[model samples]
Target chain A: LAKTTQPISMDSYEGQEVNITCSHNNIATNDYITWYQQFPSQGPRFIIQGYKTKVTNEVASLFIPADRKSSTLSLPRVSLSDTAVYYCLVAHGAGGFKTIFGAGTRLFVKA
Target chain B: DVKVTQSSRYLVKRTGEKVFLECVQDMDHENMFWYRQDPGLGLRLIYFSYDVKMKEKGDIPEGYSVSREKKERFSLILESASTNQTSMYLCASILAGEDSNEQYFGPGTRLTVT
Candidate 1:
């Protein structure tokens, strides 16, 4: 499993876009970048995933450069409800492989 | 939607008591995992099962055990509950075949050992 690095916390205002970046310099070819959002007292939910380039979903967009060393999770027009810890993980697949969640980026969305 | 259901949302147990945590998934997924979350530690894997009756220890499996008798159900057992073992436990399941992008998580169970 590849280790990921992210900021401990970030502050964003409502209606503003927020981007959280994760770095995994030694990402393997088979690995994919996945982001999860976790609210207080709730299990982490899947936000977006990408293998390369860009992948967009209803909630967020993932941008992975060609180097695959790092990726960014972009949340457009954020709201106060989006205040939560965002986690980035690198995995080959979600089988029996254990996911290592680092100290996630805590996003505080203020109105 | 894939739903992973844990038997309990909250539990309280005394020291040295036997505790059982049950997890069931309705999507017929081949993989199920158990993790415990604590402050400053994030989430730590306790155990995982890839197939029926097959189990694997995860990052922090000491003082814990798991049983997978069927494909849809996975159980985490604590032979002797300790106060240090108090934490929030989460259960998750993922599809077995290709394109297993994300794992679905269940509403966690907060266990309190006294």
Candidate 2:
């Protein structure tokens, strides 16, 4: 498993775009970068995933450079409800594999 | 939306008592996992099951055991619950073959052992 490092916390305002970056210096070739969003007392929810380049979804966008060593999760037009902890994980497959979550970036969206 | 239901949302138990946390999935997902979340430890895998009768020990499986008797159910058992064992437990399920698909998680169970 590749080790991941991300910001401990971030602050953003409503209607502003927020980007959280994760660095996996030793990322594996077979690993896929996945981002999850979690609110207080609730389980983490899947946001977006990408191997390289850009992958966009309704909730977020994932940007992975060619090196695959780092990735960024972009949330468009943030709101107060978007205030939550975001986790960046590197997982291989869906065969009951284990995923390691970092301390996660705590995004506090302000009004 | 895939539904992974945990048996309890909150539980309070005493030390030395047996603890059982149940999880069931309605999507027929072949993989089920147990994880514990703490303040700074993030999410640590306790155990995972690939099939009905097969299980694999994860990074932190020493103080816990798991059982999967049916395809849709997985149970985490603490033989003698301890104070350190108190944490938020989360259950997750994913399809068997999707390599890049995301996992569906159930509302976590918060266990407090005193």
Candidate 3:
């Protein structure tokens, strides 16, 4: 499993684009980066995932450079409801595996 | 869409009591996992099962056990509940193979042991 580091907290205003970056200096070739969003008292929801380059989805976009050591999650036109804790995780791609989550980046979206 | 349902949204138990957390997934995913979440500590895997009757211990397996009698159901058991066990428990399931990057999670059970 690769270790991931993320900002403890971030603040963004409504209608602004927010990007959260995660660093996995020792990420493995077989590992993949995934992100999840969790509202208070709710389970984390899958946001987006990428191995390299950029992958975009309806809710967010994941950017992974060729180095694959780091990745960024971009959320466009944020709203107050977008406020939540975001987790960046790196783990093996197949079978049953588990990875530890870091102190996720707490994004506080304000009006 | 994958639907993972837990038996309870909230539970209260007394110390030394046995506790069981049930999780069922409709997608028929082969892999099921149990995790506990705390305030400062992020999600910690308690146990995971690859297929029916086959289980693996995760990072924190002490004081916890799991049983996967069928492909769709996985249960987490606490032999004797304690106050320190009061936390949110989450269940997740994923399909087999590399593209199984997305793990669908249930609503989570908030267990309170007094």
Candidate 2 has what TM-score? 0.97
Which docking category, incorrect, acceptable, medium or high, applies to candidate 3? medium
Which one wins by DockQ: 1 or 3? 3
Query: In candidate 3, which residue pairs clash?
Result: none
Native-referenced DockQ of model 2: 0.68
Q: Decide which is better by DockQ, 2 or 3.
A: 3
For model 3, the stretches where C-alpha displacement exceeds 4 angstroms are none
Give lDDT per model, in order: 0.90, 0.91, 0.91
TM-scores, all models, native as reference? 0.96, 0.97, 0.96
Expressed as tens digits, the lDDT of each residue in A13-111 for candidate 3 is 999999999999998888889999999988898898888899998999999999999999999999999999999998787643876577789999999
Error of 2 at B107 (Å): 0.4
Candidate 1 lDDT by residue in tens digits, B18-90: 9999999999989899999988777888998889999889889999999999999999999999999999999
Q: Which stretches of candidate 1 lie over 4 Å from their true place?
A: A94-96
Docking class for model 1 is medium
lDDT of 1 by residue, A1-111 (tens): 788999989999999999999999978888888899999988899888888999998899999999999999999999999999998988875352777777789999998
Error of 3 at A2 (Å): 1.2
- For candidate 2, the docking band is medium
